[model samples]
Target: MRIGLLTEGGYPYATGESALWCDRLVRGLAPHTFDVYALTGDAGQEPAGRLPLPPHVRAVRTAAPGDAEGGGPGGRSDRCGYGRRERGRFEAAFADLAYGVCAGDVDTGAGPHADPAERFAAGLYALAELARAHGGLPAALRSETAVRVLESACRASGARRTLAAATLPDQLAVVEQWERLLRPLSLDWYDASDGLGRVDLCHAASAGAAALPGLVAKRFFGTPLLVTEHGSRLRAHYLATAGAPFTTPVRALLAAFHGRLAGEAYRRADLLTPGNAHTRRWQERCGADPDRLRTVHPGMDAERFAETGEHEDSGDPATLAWIGRVEPAKDLVALLHAFAAIRRRQPDVRLRIIAAPVRDADAAGYLALCRSLAAQLFPAEAAGAHAAGESPVSFEELGSPEAPTLEDAYAAGAVVVLSSVAEGFPVGLVEAMFCARATVSTDVGAVVEVVGGTGLVVPPRNPTALADACLALLRDPGRRHRLGAAARARALELFTVEQNLAAYRGLYLELLSHAPVRHRAAPGVPFAHPAESHVPGSWADRPAAPATSAPVKATATTVAAAPGDPDA
Candidate 1:
């Protein structure tokens, strides 16, 4: 089976969150071919410096978020502006989206007839058609004409109560943000030249902006889309919109837009795979059918932490180790308060905060705040020579002689502590599990789901609960050993690249089996194994059914004969 691995700011890019896992998955599934459709976020992720790919990857095509701004040359397939019929469809669909959002009629929940899903799908396809005719959607979605169209739609009958209450400015502000975010749908990536229309399945690494093109491919080419979200896209959007400088009404309107898009993705995708149950519930709430949803945990490199489990353990017996990017979300303030309690109960206890390598300026600020808090917490203890030498709490970067690697960081403590008030998946907890170390994590995001009773779960921002959990693990080495063993067992069983590949391999064949082969050759061309298959390691070496010829017109555009097409 051929798989179109769709990603945004990841995969082929050497510097994104999902790059390593995606590379591992593609490499593991040698039986299938992959074509990477990467939507990068910046120039730094240019394909020229992409990760080394395995032979199974046939091609790598990329378009950045920046591409939607029309910053470079005009798109290759641009036609003139839309004609009357297409323009009508675009106007109608755009109005439906605006009115649905404005009126609170956008249902981001499961129901037999959800208008948000319909609105998003209709608007998306309409935009796609418009982009195919015009250069792209930039001029159309943001134009004065577009805003006026939306207002007209809001006043139309069947519009929601919110629309009736909304002013013209509220409507325009919402439309502007929606247009900017939905730009991915207008790209030419789904055309015949791109492999998107041809693949047996389209697997998006995450939801949100990255998954937009996959939704388009599914709509335009009838591609079987499989959307996987490790972090809940809707939740992230809500958080971002809340903090954004936009007005409350604008945020509400954009939130409605995001909620609608997510619902559409869930409704349209053949299957939805969230990394954990926390995200799965979010998807379900956002209108994903329960039957089509599966929870597939993100795979990680277990081997990297194996050595830490075996040797060079965290030396302080009562020490609590925090490993991850030192961001405010990690809740270092809470960790410090908890550690203070631990210090008061047992003065010898130490706290080791492991900081991720800082390439981002924002991370530097977070680290500084953590350092000041740690100093204030232990001020008298570190007032004189101790401050200059060894402190009770210290911030350590990833690579140092004292804490050389991730393994070293894990081994340096008896308990791995995660105090983050906000989290997607506690990646640090998984790393600790790989190192065969016990963990104490605050209940947030997918923490309880990922840990799965393998560690101690405390309430978020509760220093007392956090301290008690760590102290329990510290005092009982036998309990610690048992938990560590179980954590490792769970990680190996469910969170390995091997397991991830197996799941997708099964899904690919399952989706294909439901659709009969629709790309058989012409009358005289035998459907037998081709000559290339006879080359030792190919399918000719394996047993096969006899050839029977019955031509089926390829309904999918990507079915056009490539170099190795069975029909050719």
Candidate 2:
């Protein structure tokens, strides 16, 4: 089967967990060919180039907003110069989006567009049709005309209080962002000859901008769409924009758009695979069909930690390890405070804050603050009598000689720790589990779900609970060993790349099985082409006779399967 994989700022173009998962997905599913439609989020990603791809990936088509993130705060816009009729069509369609955002909602409506979600979907597709018919919609979306329509909707009856409070500049800001989010509609990927339309299924990496194209493909060509997100996109947006400088009105408008888009995508998708129950709840709350949802945790490669798991008793009994990116969200400060409590209970116990490579611009500052706090909390001079100049707390990078590989990092600790206050899928926790190590993590995101009953989980941001949980495993070696063994078995059975591949491979075939089987060679069918069809030619009328006994010569009848045979 042919699969169209949709993504944003990940897969072949970037590194880290999201990209790694996408790469494995494409490579692991060797039976099905893939066509990747990637949307880059950063300018730097283009220069870095793509990761090595397997032969099964047939094509890679990419787009940046307007050549370079167009129509954003400081980016160029794709000008769609619409004449009179086109302008009217755009205005009418855009008005539905505005009304849906400002007023028409589940609670307030009684008409043809009673459901605000319906209004939102209608407007989104109408604009998409306009873009498809008239090239694109960047100029119109960023025009004074769009601003006027938004303002009028804000003042209309039944308009929400927050939206009505929006100022002119706020409207402009919202319009700028909307144009970027809707940029996928203007892409030429829906062509039947050699693009998304020809694929048997559309598999979106997430429900954000990546899934927009899938929605369009399903609408245009009846292709089945499957959206998977290890980290929920709506949750990320709410977290990022929480304390921004924008007023409530602008935030509300943007949020309304995001929510509606998410709901529409949820409603239209043939299946939705959220990474964990944490994410599944969010999708369910936003109106995803309960029957269509599945909780598929993103898998980790167990072989990466094979050596560490094999020698489970190698780590120092007194050491506790924390492994992940050194970002503010990880709450290293809280971890430091927890370690201070651990120190009071046992002076010889050590805490190692082993960070993965930092990516965010603010990570350096966060790491610096963590280092200073650790220094003040446990002065080296104070511990001179016991460990002889060792402060009992150490900071190291993953690639350092002491902890060179992933296995080395896991082997450095008797008890692995995760102190994140806001996590998504807990890749580090799963790594610890794969390495057969006992873990103590904060109760956030998918930590509870991923850890299951294998590891200890404490409430997030509570230093005392975190310290207590770590101390329990540190004091009892036998319990640690038992938990470690159980964790490894769970990881091997439930979270391997092999398991993920099996799940998705079945899902892809299942969707295709139910769909109307259209031949690639079927002429005059929409989105049908000769791309994957067998080359037509004349064949022998009858099967060749069997070779005579003792005759060693090659014959057509001796062949295992014939090329043009109907059964073959």
Candidate 3:
């Protein structure tokens, strides 16, 4: 099967949220071909180039969010050059879309037979079709006319009160953002011969703009779409726009747009796969059908940590280790306080913080703050003996002679600690499990689900609870040993690369079996029939039995059945 893998700021890129997992999936499923459609987030991401792609990847097409600004080679003219009829159609459709956004509830009742969701969907697709027909969306989408239309919609009756206070600047900001988010409508990737229509299944790595093309493919052609969300796109958008510089009305309008998009994507997808239960619940709240939702955990390589898992007894019993990118959401401050508490009880205990380098300047500032806090919490023991009895807290990075790799960092301590207040999948905790190290993680995101009773769980931002949990395992070697053993087993069973590949392989075939097959034959072909098996023996001439009651419907059982079965 050929898969169209759609992503934003990830996969093929050297850095991004879902880059590693997407790379692994493409590499693991070698029998299937992949065509990647990536929407890049920034200019810095392009300089790193892409990860080496496997042979199964047939093509990589990328577009940046800024591509809609009308300054590039394919950018449209500033005047729009719309005919009178086309201008009227554009005005009508844009008004409906903007009004739906300002109203705050895209599916709410405008009337008894209104169907607001259908209105939103109709307006969006109408604009997409218009853009396709005209070669691209007019630069008018980013013009003052667009902002004026948006302002009018905000002032319409039944609009939210928050939208009533929107000024010209706020309207302009919203229109600019909308242009970027709707850029997919101007792309030429919907053709049946060479674009998304050629794939058997369109798999969107996340929602919002990345899934926009997949949605278009399903709408223009009869392609099946599968959307996977490791982190809820709606939730991320809300968090990012919460305290942004935009006005309240602008924020509300942007939120409503993303919410409506997510709802539409959920409604149209043949299947929804969330990386964990935390993400699954978010999707459910956004109106995803429970029957279509499936939870698939991200995979990690267990073989890389095999040596550390086998020798769990080698780490220092009095040391606690924390490994991950240095960011404020990780709550490194809380971890330092918890460590101080642990030190008061056990003075000889040490903490090693192994941080991964990040591209964001804010994260670097956070790392510096963490270092200052560590120094303040643990004062140097006599200035001259800084090396002799150095502060028990030490910050290190990977690739140093002391800790060369992630596995080496996990091996430096008997218990791994995670104090993140906000998280997605707690990948670092899972990596600890892969190394057979007992963990003490705060209860956030999917940490509890991933741990599965194999390690200690404490509430977020509670220093006392975190310290106590770490102390409990530190004081009892037998309990730690048992937990570590169980964690290794669980990680190997459910969180390995092999299990992840099998789940997706099955899902791909299941979706394809139900989808209508596209005929790619030439126009002159008699029946437009694809090649079928032809046996050149006596059995080929035998008449087939024709009295079967009816064909059996395919179920999950039949779809997953082994080959060579009569029913198969």
Candidate 4:
């Protein structure tokens, strides 16, 4: 079956979230054809070039948010130039959407009207239809008339108080952001013959902008949308905008718009696969159907750490390793403080801070500060007869001789430590598990879930708790060995790349099997010809497989339970 895989800032790109996982999935499921629709975040992400795509990818279409600058789909010269009638249509639709956003109230309770949600959806589809007819929405959405419509809606009697306070600049910013976020509506990827309409399933790699196209495909062509969110995009938006320069009203309005979008996506999606329970809970809070939600953990290749897993005693008995990008969120400062406490308790203990490449200026500054703090905490000793030149707290990169690779980094310590104040799936912790190394991680994001009784989890930002956990592991080699062995067993059983591929493949087949078969009927033939069979096999000699026009029915048993269930 052909799949329309949608992504935002990921996949095919050399750097982006989920690039590796998406590439692995596409390669693993070589039997299916994929049409990639990528929404790049910026120009720089593609400079290093994309990862080599597998042959099964039929085509890849990329669009950046900056594309909205040209006014619309075909550019400034090809603007839709809406007529009086189209202008009226745009006014009504845009007003409804803006009102729905400013209202800031969607009935998410049981059996509620969901009027705000429905209005937002209705206005959204109307704009999409207009864009499809006119070749783009930029010209209309960018007009002064659009700004007036938004202002009127925000000033309406029932609007949120924050929105009523929006100034002209705030209005302009909100409208510009909406234009960018809604750019997918102007895309020509919905045609039945050549675009998303032709695919059997629309798999969105994440929510928000990337999932918008999938929502459109499902709405227009009845294509089943499978939304897999590794991180809750809605939550991310709220966090990201917390410090934005925009006015409170503008931020509130934008948040409402994104909230409505998430609700609609969740409502329309046939299946919601969150990478972990943390994301699943966020989806559920946004009104995702409990029955439709399934937790599919991100997969990692264990073979890369197989050698380390087999030889658990190779690492230094006193070293504690922290492997990941050095960012503020990683709380390396707290790690440093905790390491100081560990040193006080055991002066011979060493800490290896294996830094991944920093991605931004902020992270670079943070790394420099961490280095300075390390110098203050463990100043280099003089080169005496038995003195080592290296600082007790060493910061090393991936290719360094001490930590040649990720597997080597995990193998360089008896206890792996994660001190992040925020995380998604705790990929590093899972990698350490794959290496069969005991871990001391902070209780953040999915660390507790991923650790699953194998590692000691401490509260984030608490140096004492972190140091105590590290000391507990350091003081007991037998316990570390037991936990390491158990961790490897759990990692192999639950988090391997093969398991992820199989889960998705099952989900795809399950969704397709239950979906209505789209086929043209022959004249005067009532079940006389077989256009397509729902079941797999050569059915040329058999009668047409029974077709049901009923909505797809999913039983409680349809989705497998989370992996490693005791009963199983």
What digit string (tens of lDDT, one per residue) describes model 1 on residues 1-87? 778898877788776557887888898888788888887867666845888888878888887655774534332222224577766
The TM-score of candidate 3 is: 0.89
Clashing residue pairs in candidate 4 are: none
Clashing pairs in 2: 66-70
Clashes of each: 6, 1, 0, 0
Task: Please provide, for model 2 over 1-568, each residue's C-alpha lDDT reduced to its tens digit, 9 standing for 90 to 100.
Answer: 8899998888878666889999989999887888999988776787888899999888898887665223444533333368889988999899988888777465554677767788878888899888888887777888878888899988988888877678889888998888888889888888765777778899998888999999999988888999998888998899889988888988998888888888888889999999899899999998899999987878778997998998888899999998888888899999999999998989889887888877677898899898888778877534573456455788889899878888899999899999888988888888899899999999999888888899999999999999999999999999999999999998898889999988888888789888764443332343332222232233322233345533122233322222332211
lDDT of 4 by residue, 314-377 (tens): 9999999989988889999999999999989998898889998777898889999998887777
Error of 2 at 347 (Å): 0.9
Cα error, candidate 2, residue 528 (Å): 11
How does model 1 score by TM-score?
0.86
Q: Where does the lowest 10-residue lDDT sum fall in candidate 2?
A: 559-568
- The TM-score of predicted model 2 comes to 0.89
**Model 1 alpha-carbon miss at residue 401, Å:** 2.4
For each candidate in turn, the TM-score is 0.86, 0.89, 0.89, 0.88
Clashing pairs in 3: none
For residue 62, give model 2's deviation from the true position in Å.
Answer: 0.4
